[model samples]
Target: MKVKAIRVHKIGGPEVLTWEEVEIGEPSEGEIRIKNKAIGVNYVDIYYRTGLHQEPLPFVPGKEAVGVVSAVGPGVTGIEVGDVVGYADTPMGTYTEEQIIPATLAIPIPPSVDHITAASVLLKGMTTYVLVKQAFKIQAGHTVLVHAAAGGVGSLLCQWANALGATVIGTVSTQEKAIQAAEDGCHHVIIYTEEDFVAQVAEITSRKGVHVVYDAVGKDTFKGSMECLMPRGCMISYGQCSGRPDPVPVSDLASKSLILGRPGMRHYTATRDELLHAAGEVFAGVAAGVLRVRVNHVYPLHEAARAHADLEARRTSGSVVLLPAMPAADS
Candidate 1:
């Protein structure tokens, strides 16, 4: 069937995200068809759009969404028609009304969570889960620093870290974002554009620095992020919204015996059990109110380009979700 979807024929600016018609087949064996209720908009989608994370000449950019099982293929069990499920793993083309995804990738959404809320948190929340739990194992009394603390993943990080009993320090460019970060559980909110973050971190930690620094802003924050860490601390560089970070000398890490990791969801959730555990934790967190997901922006699927532009400009906070522009012809 033909569906109205966003396609990138050439990698460039947000302008390259084209709303066009594409044909997709029904789910084959071990796959299921999803009539998407809400699609997730992430910064990583921008990476794919601009070719910073390269794909083929034409491709779909989004990685996650919450949808209903419209059709179940042969041999697909554990899920059936009418079930509400969410997925953050591959088949990479979610900026559409419907998609066929591997059954294994689908995680059922609890009744307490709405489609928009599930779409908002599935990917970002799971990443936060791994970063805090597996990446460094944040604990009570630990000091944590989060770069872009008001961003999609950043907001979740601050809240989750705080819930883990860490004192959260967040850095943002504007006073507005600082407020948001603080509300999300940052004990200290630094307006990086107006103040020096490294110095502020020193003051916040009494010059001892943080136990872990989550730097997603990439190049601009990378060097300073390392400085914000205490001896033997972990630096989790998961994203590069500013640009790829410059290479580091061995001495930079040797000085403090620092640990650096650049983790991706694919790396942490490669196995079925791992994926379910991570996503399950996020869903449970949301249900129990440990994770307060913020769906601050909602755009119709056709206007994803505008969504991308706002995201790149840092004009958006919390999480963003996309609703289908119109219903499927079959529906």
Candidate 2:
């Protein structure tokens, strides 16, 4: 049978995202065919589309999606047909009406969580989980700085860290985003375009500096965010929306015994067990009201090109998900 999906033929602008029909054969052993309900649009997709990340061209480029099992192929038993599921796994084919995903990667969604919310949360929520729960382990009395506080991962990170009893300090480019970040439980916000976040962090921490800095803004905020960290503090440069962070001098690392490096949700949840554990924490947080998802935009799957345009143009405020041609009725 055939399915509709967004395909990128060559590296370029958002114009590269094209919706086309492609054949989808029955799933192989250990795989399951899914009828997509909703799909998440992440900044990483833009990086891939523009050749910044350099994936194979003429590809379907999406990582997170929510759907229902239409057919479970041979050797799959746990997830039966009609089961709702979501995933943050690879293969980059979620921008579609249907997909064949590995059974190992899909996680069953609870009845309380709708497909759109599940799709929206899978990638961003897991990123936040790894940032707070895995990397630095945000705990009581810790002050943390999150760059791009109004963006998808930042919005959730602020609230999650706050719930963990840490004071959340967010950096945003605009006054509106600053307000949004503040409202999302951020204890403080730095308008990075106007003020030096390093200075603000120093003032906020009484010159002691924060315990950790969660930086995804890359080149633009790397130096400043690092400067705001205390001795032996950890700096996680997880994403490079502004551009990849440059090499840091070994002397700088040794000078303050600073801990800094880049990491991703892929490594953090590499194994199926790890993925399940991370998803469990995320769902629990959402169920308990500790984490609130911010879905700011939803475009039809065919309009994925426009979605990418908005994301790359910095015209989006929060999470954006692409809805399938026929959205499922919440059950």
Candidate 1 C-alpha lDDT tens digits along 78-99: 9999999999958699999889
Candidate 1 residue runs with Cα over 4 Å from true position: 325-331
- Per residue, candidate 2 scores C-alpha lDDT tens digits across 228-277 of 88898899898889997888887887877998867778898889899999
Could you tell me the C-alpha RMSD of candidate 1 in Å? 2.7
Where does candidate 2 clash, by residue pair?
none
Query: Model-by-model lDDT, in order?
Result: 0.92, 0.89
Query: Which candidate comes out best when scored by lDDT?
Result: 1
